[model samples]
Target: MRRIVQFSTGNVGRHSLRAVIGRPDLELVGVHASSPAKIGRDAAELCDWSEPTGVIATDDIDALIGLRPDCVVYTALAETRPMEALEQLTQILAAGINVVGTSFVWLAAPRYAGDWVREPLEKACAAGGSSLYINGVDPGYSGDTLVHTALSLATRVDSITVQEIFDYANYDDAEYTGAAMGFGVAEDEELPPLFLPGVVESMWGGPVRALADGLGIVLDEVRQRTERWFTPERIDCTMMTVLPGQMAAVRFAAEGVLDGEPVITVEHVNRLTAAAAPGWIFPPDGHVGVHRVVIEGDPRVEINTHVSHPLLDPTDAACISTAARVVNAIEWVCNAPNGIIAVEDIPQAAIMNGLMWRAK
Candidate 1:
C-alpha cells in the first residue's frame, strides 16, 4: 500500500483525507496543518472520522519528511501564497517524495504558465527524481480540457464554448460566496478590469487556452467580462438593505481567440434570489449547467454534465473526487517521459480504468 500525507484542513483537504483513508491501496499515514489549534488531534477527528487513526496533525515539515510517505496531497488556498505552496511542494519532491496538489496553477497546463513557474519546478523534481501533478473539478475538468477531450471524437469544428452555471444561494460561506459570485456588491463597484487580476478567470484560463492550442489554433487574444446583481427586494436569506430594483445577479464570461478572432468562450453564472430578469442572463433556469461543451462542426456535438449534489459539496466530496483522480495518477506520472504534462497528456483509458480500479 502507498503511504500518503495530507496537507491542510480546508474543505478540499478534509474531503481528500477521508477518501484516501478509505482506499485500500492507499494508507493515511499523517495529516499536517499550519494551525496550532489542530496539531496533536487525531486525524480522524480533524476530518470527522468515525474510526481513529493514530496519526496526529502537526506543523513539523521535517517530521513529515522523516515519515517518508510516497506522496503528499496538498489542497491549500491557491489565490494567496500559491508560489509559497509550490516552493514547499518542490521541497517535498526534492526529498524524493511524489506530490499531488491543487495549489499551483501551473500544473493545470505547464505550457500556459510558460517557463516562469514550470521550468523551475520541473528542474526541482528532476533533481529529486520525483513527480508532481495537479488537478481539480472546475479548472481541471469543466474547462476546455474536457472540451478538447470531447473534440477528439469530432472530425471538424467551427467554435467551442463551455459554461458552468449553478444556484449559489445554498452556499452559506460568506467569504466564498461573496468573492466567488460577486455577491453583496453594487453593479458599479470600481473593480479592476475583468481577468486583469485573474480573479474572475479562476485558474481554468490555462485549461481553456491549452485546449485551444491543442486544437491547432494560435490564440492571439482573450476577453473576459463579468456582471453582478443583488436581491431587488429584501429576501429571507439576504440581509442587505434594498427597497426595490436592486442588483441580484452576477455573470462572468471569458473568451479565447485565434488571430484576434474569438473561438472559445467560457462562462460562469450565479443567482441568489428568484431567477428573474437579470438573473436569467446570469444563470438561465431549467438546468444547472455544471458543464456545457458545445462543438459546432460537422455533427455538432454538445456535452452536458451535472455533478451529484453530495459530490458537489466543495468542502468534502467534490474536491475529494478530484483529488482522488489526481492522486491515483501519481504512479503513471512518475514513469511518464519527463518534462511538463497535463490531464490530456495521460491516456484516457488509464484514467478511466484507474478510477474504476480505485472504486473497487
Candidate 2:
C-alpha cells in the first residue's frame, strides 16, 4: 500500500482524508497542521471521525518527513501566500516524496506561472526524483475536464462554453463567499484579482486555447470581464442574511480568440442573493446551489446539469469533489511525462476511473 500524509484538516482536507482512509490501496500514515490546537490530536478525532486513529497531527515538518511516507497530499488554503507552501512542497519533493496538491493553480499551466514559483518547484522535483501534480474541481476539473468532455461529442467544433451557476448564500464566511463570487472592495479581502480573472484564466485558459489549437485555430488574445450585483435590502437564507448591498452576485467571463474572433468562452457565476434574471433561481429545489455545463458546438450538445444536494452544501461538495479527483489521479500523474499538464492530457480511462472511484 502506498503511504500518504495529508497536510490540512480543513473542509477539503478532511473530505480527502475520509476518502483516503476508505481506500484499500492506500494507507493514511500521518497528518500535518499549522494550528497549535490540533498538533497532538488524533487525525480521526480532528476530522470528527467516529473513532481515533493513532495518527497524530504535527506542526514539525522534519518529524513528518522522518516518517518517510511515499506521498503528501497538500490541500491548504488557496489564498494564503503560496511561496511558503511552494517551498514546503519543494522540501517534500526534495525528500523524494511525490506531491499531489490542490494549491498552485499554475501547475495546470507552467508557462503562465512566473519564474519565481515554477522554476524552484520543478528543480526540487527533478532533483529529488519526485513528481508533483496540482488539480481541483473549479479550475482543474470543471473548467478543463468538463470542457474536454463536452468536446468529445463534437463532430465539427466552432466554440466551447462551460458555465457554473450556484447560490453562494450558504457560505458564512464573507471573505470566502466574496472570493468565490469575485467581490474585491475591502483592503483585508483575500478575494483578489487572481481568483477573479488572472488565476481563473491561467487555469482554464490553457485548456481552451489547447482546444482551439487542436482545431487548427490560431489564437490571438484572451480577455476577461467581471460583473457584480447587489441587493438594496438585506435578505435571509435558511440561516442568516449575508449583508445588505454587499456583493450579492458576481460573474467572471473569460473568452479565448483566434484572430480576434471568439473560439472558446468559459463563464463562472456565483449568486448569493435571490435571482434577478429569468431561469436563475437560488436554492432551487431547496438546495444551496446548482451547477450546469452547457457546450455550444457545430451541431450543439450538452450534458449533465449536476445540481447540489439539499442534504449536502454545494461549495463544500465542489471543493471536496475537486480534491478527490486530483488525489485519485496521483498515480497517473506520477507516471506521465512532466512539464505542465491539463486534464485533457490525462487518459480517458484514468479520468473515468477517478470519477468512478469518487462515486464509489
Candidate 3:
C-alpha cells in the first residue's frame, strides 16, 4: 500500500482524501488542511466518514512533509495561486514525495507551462527522486485522453473538439463562480480571470498541445475566443446571486492552430442554469454536465460522457472523478521515474484498474 498525504480539504481535496481512505492499496497518513475549521480535526471528520483514520489535519507543511509519504495528493486550488502552488508542489517533490494532483492544469502539458513553471519542478524531481502528475476531469480526461481515444477510430483526422458543458447553478463555490468565472458580473466590467487574455491558453493550451502532440502535428499557435450571456432576471444560485443584465453564462474555446487552421479545440459552455443560455449547448438527457468529444474526420465521431452520483449532483460527481483520476495515479506515479509524468505516459489499464476493480 502506498502511504498518501492529502493536501487541502476543499471540494476536490475532500473527495481525494476519502478515496485514499477507501482504497486498500493506499494508506492515509496525514492531511494538510487549509481551512481553519478543518485544521486540528481528524481527516475522517473533514469528509464525514464515520470511522476515524488516525490522521489529523494540520496546516504544518513541514510536519506533513516529514511524514515521508510515498505520494502527496496536492489538490489545493492552483488557479488563484499559480506560483505558490508551483512552489508548494516543488517543496513536496524536493522532499522525496511523489504527487498526483488536480491543480496546475497547465502542467498536464508541461512543455506549454513555460520554462519558469517547468524548470523548478524538473529540478525538484531530480533532486528528490520523485515524480509529479497533474490533471483534472476536463484537462485531465475530456480533452486529452477521451479525445485521443475517439481519434483512434478515425482513419483521417481533420479537427478535434472537446467540450465541457455544465450548469453552475448547483456548483456552490462563490469565489469561483462569482469572482473567477464572472457569473454574476456585468459584461461591461473588467472580465474575470478565466476570460482574461492568455488565461484560457495558460489553463487549457496544455490539452490542446497534448492533442497536437498525440497526432504528431505541430501547432503554429494557440488562440482563445470568449462570449458571455446575460441573465434576464434575478437568479439566486446556491452560492451567489445574479442580477438582471449580469453575466449568467459563458462560452469559450482555446484553439490549437496549425498552418492558421484550428485542428484541436477545447471549448466550455458554462451557465448559471439551463434557463440562462437558450442557444448554447446543454448536457444531453437533461443531465447537468457532460464532457463531449467531437472529431471531424473520415468518420465524423462524437462521444458524450456524463458523470453523476445518486447522492451527489452532476458537478460534484465530476469533482469526485477529477479527484479519483489523480488519486488512482498515485501508485504508478510512485513507481515511475522521477520527473513530470504526462497523462499519455499512463497506460489505459493502469488508469482503469482501480475504477473497474472491487474487493471480492
Root-mean-square deviation of every model? 3.5, 3.6, 1.6
Best candidate, TM-score-wise?
3
lDDT of 2 by residue, 265-312 (tens): 767767654542223434335555545455666668675445344556
Instruction: Name the 10 consecutive residues with the lowest summed lDDT in model 2.
Output: 275-284
The TM-score values for the models, in the order shown, are: 0.85, 0.85, 0.96
The all-Cα superposition gives candidate 3 an RMSD in Å to the true structure of 1.6
Give the distance in Å from residue 98's predicted Cα in candidate 1 to where it truly belongs.
1.3
lDDT of 1 at 327: 70
lDDT digits (tens) for residues 1-360 of candidate 1: 778889887767787787777777678887889888888898888777788889999988889988998878877765557677767777787888877777675567656775657877788788877777777766667674568666877899888877766655545544544554545555566543332466544455676677777777877766677665556565444423332444455677767877676688777665664453452643334544356678888778887766555445422334565676677675576566544567867786665433443331
Once superposed on the true structure, which residue ranges of model 1 sit more than 4 Å away at CA?
187-202, 235-248, 273-278, 281-289, 309-317, 337-339, 352-360
Evaluation by lDDT, superior candidate among 1 and 3: 3
TM-score, ranked from best to worst: 3, 2, 1
Candidate 3 residue-wise lDDT, 1-360, digit = tens: 788999998889999888888888888999998778888899989987778988999999999999999999999988788888888999999989999899888787776678888899999999999999998887878977788789889999899989999988888887764688788889788878988788888888878877787789889998999999998889887757899999999888899998988888899999987779889878888888889999999999999999989889888899999998898788788889999998878886786656544422
Output the TM-score of candidate 1.
0.85
After superposition, the stretches of candidate 3 with alpha carbons farther than 4 Å from their true spots are 354-360
